[model samples]
Target: MYLPGPVYDVVSVDIGGQVLAPEQYRVDAAGRLVRVGGGCWPDCQDMAAASGEPDTFTVVYRVGLPVDQAAVAAVSELTCHLLKGCGGSGSCGCKANRNIVRYSRQGVDLEMPDPQIIYSQGRTGLSLVDLWLMTVNPHRLDSPSRVYSPDFRYPRVQQWP
Candidate 1:
């Protein structure tokens, strides 16, 4: 079975008829990696057929949130902007001014950006971040889709009934 998402750690792996050692593979934030063109076959194989033999290419790994550096940078930039606009230590008393009529506070007129427009337009006021997300995560799906079969039945604990 091909495991998806960012694999952080790999517990074990079996390929061909031999079990791979810890030194054979390395797990990183991005994914798991093994020696190229290593194992039973001449070339590295991602998947293998099921066999009654000892060699069953199987892998055990822990999948985690696939957050990349670009995403982190994007979130950080948005957070910084909010903190700068509104005081982080305490409220600056500058509420959102969404009204069309200009409002003045301390001789400075300000108008709050329309939240409805931003939401409807799917914009975060950050062009670069929006572009990155649009390219990297357009649908915003957290994980890959898994196929489910309704015909598959699970074992029942009640045998007498």
Candidate 2:
């Protein structure tokens, strides 16, 4: 099974209410939960045999990066801006004009905010979102913040010695 990756750590592994030790399994670089040594999982044709009596193997791990409220708001505002021009129109593939150019007796004018430009730089046009990200997570990392501690033990599958 393919597991979503960049996982911070595996919290626990349980089989029928029995918690397995960290040594029993390891998480590979590809983020696969692989059984190691004499683990409980077996290579058996029958599903019953693969799962020990009373059957159930559970892997508890953190999933996805952190998404704060600021990000949500930023995305929402951007979406709103993009959809602003579409008034009462159904989803008929019509989108708001990226560049609104108009001419008047006084002068010609243009009104457009390039969201693509902001997104390409890992930034949202919204000031609050950009500020929040800058304060909490600099470097514009798309992944969640990872805090490593010596006291905390994590299971790892070593593909090579």
Candidate 3:
């Protein structure tokens, strides 16, 4: 079975309340869980029981791309930007000039980009943070895209009494 995300590691796999040994299955590079030794996953499981109960299949895994040097740099930049003037004097530097869309002093003029516009475009005001965001998610999707079909068997959920 293929997992939805880029799985980093599989911690455990449980079926019918029994934790399967690592030798029983292996996760492929593409995040597909393949059964080993000719064993097969159950075609159907009882959903009424809580996960890990009898007739349940559960997979514990970590998802996401592995953090690299570029990711570390991006996060550090964002953290520094957010922590600006956090431990300073009575005046918080970060708070000053936050809402000044336009400013003029001594024949000098400056215009600040509106924060709402940046937020609406799924970007942070910080350049490094926004660059990293754009590199990773150019489309600015809130979640991964999924295809739905009427024939698909979605898990049952008790929605109403």
Candidate 4:
């Protein structure tokens, strides 16, 4: 079955409280969990039962793209920006101005882009953070998309469970 990923690892798979061996299934390049052995996934599961209980199916996995140097740098930049003036004496010069759209003093004017506008466009005002966000999710998708085919027999998952 399709699992939302760039799946890094499969921790465990349980069917009816019994753990499946790694040999029984494999994660394909497309992140599909394919049954490798003769057995098949159950067509139906008990909705009321907790995961790992009898008649329930569960798969525990880790999902995300591997963190690289660019990601680390971006996070570091954002963290430094956030902590700039959080805890220190009054003389500390660093200040985070998240909400100032316009400033005027002695006939000189300074205008900053609206923070609301930036947020609406799925961008942070911070350069590194916005750059990283744009690079990773240019379209600003909230979640991965999925397609369903009538011909395909999808495993039944209990909605409430």
Candidate 5:
């Protein structure tokens, strides 16, 4: 299958763990990693860079087909895959890989999507807002004395009159 973004290879459970797969490698002429040949369509270096920052991350939505329920289910499925992603769910702010991995069917009810982004602001390198946005537990990696999310911001929508 085609994994849409760059394979940042969430390899181990931590930022500094041994890797277990082929990831972004450079090509002499290419200068950047050759991701096109790999299954990853969009290069992931940019996203990874953002994730490793102090207070930045992104949430993206892509709809392959607009109306099919199955297509919608793909969102949940994709989200599940993301949650199950290799880096051991440390910062992607998602449920344990089990819940997402075992899910075979998809529906809005089963979908509690989380962010694909990460930041280094809070105690665990992420804020509660980040976790909440990604449907992940803010205390997943807590050490019993962690404080609130550092980047917890409540942005309201502006209604134009």
Candidate 6:
């Protein structure tokens, strides 16, 4: 699942979201594929339970704004990203998804989709960040909190959107 380079133009990185770079993957002592962090791959389990308010959650983004500077400038919307089950306590059941497929990449046009990700946790105002630059405050998504890839390859873009 490892891509050679970084995946850009991201919107939202939610629990069970997909697409990641090689460096994001986590391996074990045996060099086994473990987990992928950064970017919203919603399948992360750690984001499952209520870490904050009920019915509201915060989302982050690691964007590569080579194109469409407008969207990059006005960074107040939901874009495609994922979490891979980081806090589920041990559940391997949800599919990785895009928060807002059309708004994530180039050319596709539509209102910035709001990923209505209702975890057992809750919801609140959304938080989008330029994760590529800021490296001070890091948070985990709601699924696949644990990184242990059955396959040796790292996480990659699902090519769905």
lDDT of 5 by residue, 1-161 (tens): 23244433322211222221333322222122233245433223243454434333232223232234544454565565566655675554443553352344555335433323223433222333344534433455554464688688644322110
Per-model lDDT = 0.59, 0.64, 0.78, 0.78, 0.36, 0.38
Model 6 Cα lDDT, one tens digit per residue, 1-161: 23222344234333333434445544332223334454433343444555343333334434232445444533533232223234453232234343544543476565533445432223322344344212222344445356776787865434212
Q: Which residue pairs collide in model 1, if any?
A: 16-55, 17-55, 97-112
Candidate 1, which segments miss by more than 4 Å at Cα? 4-11, 14-19, 22-59, 64-68, 77-101, 126-128, 134-161
Ranking by TM-score: 3, 4, 1, 2, 5, 6
Candidate 5 TM-score to native: 0.15
Tell me how many residue pairs clash in candidate 2: 1
Q: Is candidate 3 or candidate 5 better by TM-score?
A: 3
Q: Tell me each candidate's TM-score.
A: 0.40, 0.38, 0.53, 0.52, 0.15, 0.14
Model 1, residue 20: displacement in angstroms? 2.4
Best by TM-score: 3
Q: In model 4, what lDDT does residue 39 have?
A: 87
Query: lDDT tens digits, residues 57-155, model 1?
Result: 667676665577888888887777678668744343235444554578898997656667866766676766787767786886667678888998654
lDDT of 4 at 23: 78
TM-score, cand. 4 vs. native: 0.52
Candidate scoring better on lDDT of 1 and 3: 3
> What ranking emerges by lDDT with the best candidate at the front?
4, 3, 2, 1, 6, 5
Residues 49-83, model 2: lDDT tens digits? 34433456666788655567877777676677558
Clashes of each: 3, 1, 0, 0, 4, 65
lDDT of 5 at 114: 31
